[model samples]
Target: MWKTMILLVLVNVINGQCSCSKFTDESSCFAYGYCLFVNGVCVEQKCEAIPYQEKCKSPLCLWKDNKCLTFKAAESTCQTLLPQQCTEYQGCYYDYTNLKCQISNNCSKLEIDQCNGQLGNGNSCIVDPFNNKCQEMTDCKSLSTEFMCLSQFPFCLYQNSSCKPSSCNEINDSVSCSIMDQCQWNNNKCEIKNCQSIKFGYQCNGKTCGFDKDQCFSCIEQYGYQFFAGLISLLFIL
Candidate 1:
């Protein structure tokens, strides 16, 4: 009888040790240090088992509400960050003067080196001849001179003494795309190329691309075609 009682106790202990999913109550789940109550179910905890927020440090996890949660880049935005936490997230900048975390839209405030950082969002900095200040360029039609239009080549084209929007496929020559800022000659067609494709440091033009440790890199890759369309719409509104 004692042997049977001992066998039953051993079986119960083994079952309790392995039965995290059987826990239906939050209190019971919390009692187990290795178990987590998530989405109305109890499961084995990994990063969530971290007791302190400061102790939670992993690229895959983010600390929130004193708990370590999975990091999801798509769910995050630049607007919902504190000034101190702004620069820590990708594609976010902290403006000291305004005391805000935001994606910078005003190209005029940026220096020459910082100008093309906004290129991914359909904004570029150009020297305004009238004011002699670096200003944002959103519309090719705003460019008064051919020299100004050609300088923004691939994005803007000079034709009929006027500047107009130029797509990558519009350029037929390989040489023209090779020398231009944002274009690459690939498969006998002019195509948009990111900074990573550039092999040499000399090929990294500070305008649309940057160089670091003999490799070319872009400032930001968050913005896409939607941003360009929005920029054109904004230009028409202005």
Candidate 2:
């Protein structure tokens, strides 16, 4: 009986090691809790093998009790968190007046960093010039300054002393559009540059595009899952 139990344990360990080897790509391999892509091959992973706390945040590993461990879903409510922990928890903020962690929907209550960090469905939270409150920026016309307009590159443009939605074909000056990150001079006319043609990190902007690790990346592809996950968590609490 003891021999049979030992054989079963050995078989399970062997199967675990070999199972990850079947995955050929990084994305597919990393999707599984027990697998990791290493040296161009997919292999079995242990939470202890990961060194950094930030890197330990995937579905497979959790950083808790000052150690990396296999992830186990836990119900950590905002009301249960202490003042310091409340600030660390996503979508929850410490209310000093109320002296508790609370789910916040009012953008006006957020500070500059917190406001800017709130990204939802391609809309970014910005301080409204009229009310001096943080809110999702939806229209180009709301931007009153050239600096503000230009900051939303490829989406808004400063033209005729007003901020307006940009159109590559509407821009007549090849010299002016050429300097812009998303526009270029093409066939003697101003045209939007292809995102693939952007070689440097500084050149990528707009709602859908981003730069990471010296490579141009789609913002939707990169951050969509994380955004949705946070949204779902917020909804559950609400």
Candidate 3:
């Protein structure tokens, strides 16, 4: 029985040393068959377990950018408010290879403000994407909201924010007269009047403004005459 026990122990030791192994490169037969050695001969017993990244998702796109990515690198490109927390947005996909936001087509842009000329032009549905103050523009020049696209592909502006000049030449368009002031439309020829506008200086009371040179000169002359008369009166008294 003692001899049987010793034989079993011996078998285990030998099996540990000759265990079947697997590796990446089959061309290198030296690492294939034999078990990996801690202090023994160099061989791989099994391939190392590769780490996997958690999946991310968004309402519009499910499972965006499933490629392996480092946390810092992924967070830099992706805007996950709760990186540590297992939130719903965590499933939104982020593609590290191209650094892009991928999501569902149903993802839509929310309205930040009612379309107004406040942006210095006129369109509608100017929106702030991702709660960021940055406003997406379709085309500031043409004011086309459709052209405005974001990196996340989740948010977009519905329309342009400002007014644009007409591209057609078919009909006469009334241009704003404030630009050139007095506008005259004669024979379809709009003529604008140019005036040498003047500005009033300070000391202008109510309706008037600027120094009265004529009034100032008269006051100076009166003071000089008073001084001369006072000198003559002193000489006569002496």
Candidate 4:
């Protein structure tokens, strides 16, 4: 009776251990759509049950033997792919709307006026210049620059029947300006310019520069050196 009970317990433990599907390599795990790695074991990865936001946009589908294959998010490695390719190749990408691989021709060309209608009410979309697909707009608060906002939200700076990039002058607070790396706010605008682009001018950011900008930065950097040097000289004198 004792031997039989021990045998049953061993069998139960083995069954519990073998319940999860195993893979020797990560590649095999991914190929089988099992991406979770736990305790040196590959386990099934559960995709979040998020609803699809829009119809699949296409023309960026992967080509094999001259045929465009629909993107399969689960089967394809999307995060590993370059973001630049997502724009350059048009639809040869896994559609973020549905999290699936899509063909380039699957997406229809959308205009600025039609973009908002593609997404849910109150949600907006941008018509990408490369593919003309109506991409859903990201929240305005999460964005830093007007150019990026315009790319994500086509209607960001609308005027004269056209959309334009937002300017740093639109920022209302010092914190927002600092977050944008515009250390100095002047004339109600983020006016610091790129120092390297102009002679003797200090670069405030990538595009703007200020004459006083370089002097201020130079003083700050030298302040530490000057302090250390003065301390050393005082020690020698003493």
* Best TM-score among the predictions, by candidate number: 2
| Candidate 3 ranges with C-alpha deviation above 4 Å | 1-113, 117-142, 145-187, 191-193, 196-238
Cα distance off (Å), candidate 4, residue 233: 54
How many residue pairs clash (N, CA or C atoms closer than 3 angstroms) in each of the candidate models, in the order given?
0, 0, 18, 25
Residue-wise C-alpha lDDT for candidate 2, range 101-219, written one tens digit per residue: 55544556676444542222334556555455666555788776676677776667888999897777777787677655456666788886665567875565543344434555443
Candidate 1's C-alpha runs over 4 A off are 1-105, 110-114, 119-122, 129-131, 167-170, 175-238
Residues 67-93, model 3: lDDT tens digits: 433222133333543332212232233
TM-scores, all models, native as reference = 0.31, 0.33, 0.16, 0.25
Greater lDDT among 1 and 4 belongs to 1
Residue 162 error, candidate 2, Å: 4.7
Error of 4 at 62 (Å): 15
The most accurate candidate by lDDT is 1
- Model 2 misplaced stretches (Cα beyond 4 Å): 1-104, 109-114, 119-122, 139-147, 150-155, 160-162, 165-238
Clashing pairs in 2: none
Clashing pairs in 1: none
Q: Give the Cα lDDT of each candidate.
A: 0.59, 0.57, 0.29, 0.38
Q: Judging by lDDT, tell me the better candidate of 3 and 4.
A: 4
